[model samples]
Target: MAAENKKKEKTATCYQDCCAEVFNFYLGHSGEHEAILQCVHSVLPEEFKRIGAGKSSLDVLGVGSGGGQVDVQMLTLFQSTFPGVQITSDVVEGSIKLSNNFKALVGKTANLKNVPFQWHIMPSEDYVKQVKATEHVKKFDFIHMIQMIYYVDDLASTIEFYHGLLKENGRLMIIVETANGGWDTLWKTHSKDLCTHTITEYRSSAEIKACLDKMGLKYDEHPVPNTFDITNCFNPKDKFGCDLIDYLTAKEDFYASVTSEVKEAILDLLKNKCSSQKDGKIMFDSTLSCILVHA
Candidate 1:
């Protein structure tokens, strides 16, 4: 990003502007969602083995469940693990468009027809505030914060608050890019210009491990391997290419705003080191890690 723009207050990354583009990128680039699902599935079976031992229904909370794609996958996993058990899912998302899209998806999916879903169109902070003010004691069997904790102000406090909401043996799951991933590398390199409070700044599995350790919390971590094809990004002038770059960097059209030197430097790293050519395809590592903490 440009130095002048960086000097000014950074704007919040708006999902409404680029949600479709992001989903399309995910669909085209890599099997990130599936990889994440696999990692989560690997960890949950053991941690949640007691979920339906006697109970018939599960209470689930999905924080920042954009479009409900992953939320549906997790809920489906729960159902498959405990057959015939109903689930009441409370989806927390700030985007109206994405929430509506999720509802539409639920309406069309045959398996999800029986599941009851509640939509809370607000940020996690607001939801926490409301719960605290109302003295609501509703507890959940599972809570998933899928790549959403970066938007939170205080990670430790937020985890504590949600951790308290979990029933006995309940699991609080979190997913984030690994420290060695390109996303973390980009943030570590360009935090002064690109990083902001609204965007996820310090949210890698390694960092989260430190937080959990400091909080005296015990958890399990799983590493997921994934890759993204970014040959289109070799062209800096193309609008779609620039938009993809912005999406990857979590900035609004970052390539368009940066100087030629800055753009060239970033692109050079992406082409030369961050990504590798295989079968004439430039693939960038997009690995992620999932952590599960007990209540």
Candidate 2:
């Protein structure tokens, strides 16, 4: 009988109305921003530190640097690690809304006074194309692609191109959610409709590692443990519950198009498997994995 019921296709939305709210909701719950910052601060290599100690300038590229919040933290760390040095950062962000927010952040951030940044308002692939079209090639000392690979059209080629942009002894840091996490489960089961066309695949460090191995690339991995509360999601009376569910599924309003039975089943699965109750709080596991490759 259950098999006879057809599942509805997942709806895609730009989240124009809810992007800020959704991002804030995730930040409040996920601890993702802090974890990534800690990962970057701790994973910085000894040689880079030594080289930076004497260098007067550094070149950096940040892909998908949304709102520049995390990018600012990363920049702060770099500044502390290599004081009295000038950093030229090329930031690539596809969304104007997000890029504008990033620019606003830059304007007000006192710590960024010394950092010079070039904003590229386009997808990573387009940035690559534009750079390649230029007669001269620009190499970067560090490139960070944090939680942005899913949006790229060609994952492997894009990564390879970024790696190629690395100068001698330079490093590339890639961050993504773990395949064993709830994100992978949701995407694998419901991605057909829920996944946006701009987002090619929901990949994890595991998949990235395999690709690196196939290419004979050497890298290091760091586990960034994270947790978020989703107890509101289980509350029938909670107004934000639906929004949380939408965020989890990466849809506009997931319940709007889903069948009652399907929605109920998804809610059940999310409650039972994706999260756990502790002290009356429904906590969801949202761990991220960071990988570092050096050239």
Candidate 3:
């Protein structure tokens, strides 16, 4: 009877709600933002120097700018690189809570006082549509989309839209998981069974590179090392662990929604295939790749 039940069970589909809480928790624990910041500091200054040459001001765009922390830091660095160059920044974020947080952060940060920011609370696709409808759309010298491509419907079109918005010698930067990373492995193996195809689309740097190549666009790629501590995920009673699992699986109430067999299979793969034991902790491979395209 047990064997028959297992055989008859259909794989549960993902149903994720607003992930702001889990996302915040992940950022606080995963150290992902810091890793990306390091990559930005290393690569962006040179690009800034090139773009800022013979320019009095720079226009910047930040897509999926969660909480605006990274955007603020990048702008601070850019201002330092080219002193007295005015910055006009436009941000697009889908979450109202995050957008509010970003605005509040910008208000408190003294360095960003001189920089003007225009906030657009919408998904990238909607923003693209709005831009298309406008007769004269503002172009950008620097556009950065970080870890948000997975939510986009069409990667190629999205890239084309943003690439078209770039000014001469401008740069567009996209950061995504590496093809061999833990998230990629999990999605590759279980996406067909678990993904909802609504909130998240499985993507990696490999696909982005291929799309850019097909479009005849030239880009440079940089690898950023990142890891997440998943030690709590093994504890059943831990709230953080449960939330982390939900975020990772891109599902809400993952364990409750799925069958025991399915849950076991996913947990097994996450533990054995996507993570490693290090100093009494499970370190998930959250390695990222940064791709930069010049226009």
Candidate 4:
């Protein structure tokens, strides 16, 4: 009877309606972009040299590239690494708003002029299907999926499809949260109660590594340490805090939608289990792992 009551309890609502706004806020506070840039600059140059070796041109693919900020920087680095090589970049992004933002960024960025970009405004699955249906598809020398692996339906097939699309000496880069990261811990513990999104899966680097291992794919991993202030999350009156909670759970108005007990449980877990105190503020474990595969 107790279990039945628990099963019937109200969970959090999905936050798809305002996901962009919430996500932007989270990005601003998280310092994620800087950390990703650092990781990319540190690890990718040598890998780029390997991929661009003996080639006068390179094909690049960016999956789920949000707003094109990181994509532009990475492509710029690639161009610098192989100044004589011609680069073609293909971007697959599902969100219209983000796609527009990416286009606008590209327009203003003068460095990207030499590299032609083919924008595909669709989900990765759709893009994959379209490519598979085409008689002859372009193979990519460099492909990257940054912080967007959770949106894919089948991890194994997704990895396989992208890996199959790589040219000789090609590289595929994936960035996702670490297994013991705060987001991972939160979702692992309370996904049944808080995660109501049908599309987004709770995945981490550990899960991706497991899928690769199952497929007999070899890869290298690098840790990217990141954190964000979560002191506002404990303050019920802070709107940013409320939005952060919603984003964290991928839910809409999470604090108000869930049962009081569930809400309290999530808060306790966030404070005590998912974060640590630093400089008088609660810091979230936003640490991510970068995985690189050669094809």
Give the number of the best model, judged by TM-score.
Answer: 4
State TM-scores per candidate: 0.88, 0.87, 0.91, 0.93
On lDDT, who's better, 2 or 4?
4
TM-score of the candidate numbered 2? 0.87
lDDT of 2 by residue, 137-241 (tens): 888888888888776666678888999998877888898888777676666666665565434466777788888888788888888887778887766567688
**Per-residue alpha-carbon lDDT of candidate 4 for residues 1-295, written as tens digits (9 for 90 to 100):** 9866533322111212346566778888889999999999999999999999999899999998988889999999998998868999999987777888899999898888777889998777789899999999899999999987877777899999999999999999999999989989999888787445543458899999999999998899999999899899878789988888777876677777889898888889888888999989999998999999979
Between candidates 1 and 3, name the one with more favorable lDDT: 3
Error of 1 at 59 (Å): 0.7
Could you tell me the lDDT of residue 137 within candidate 3?
Answer: 88
Q: lDDT for each of the candidates?
A: 0.77, 0.75, 0.85, 0.85
Worst 10 residues of 1 by lDDT: 6-15
- In model 4, the runs with Cα more than 4 Å from the true position are 1-18, 198-200
Candidate 2 achieves a global lDDT of 0.75
Q: Any runs in candidate 3 off by more than 4 Å, and if so which?
A: 1-18
Estimate, for each residue in 1-295, the C-alpha lDDT of model 3 and write its tens digit: 9866532221111112255766887888889999999998998889889988988889999998988889999999889998888999999887788888899999999989999899898778779999999999899999999988877778899999999999999999999999879999999888876555344458889899999999999999999999888878767689889888877886677778778887899898898999988998888999999999989
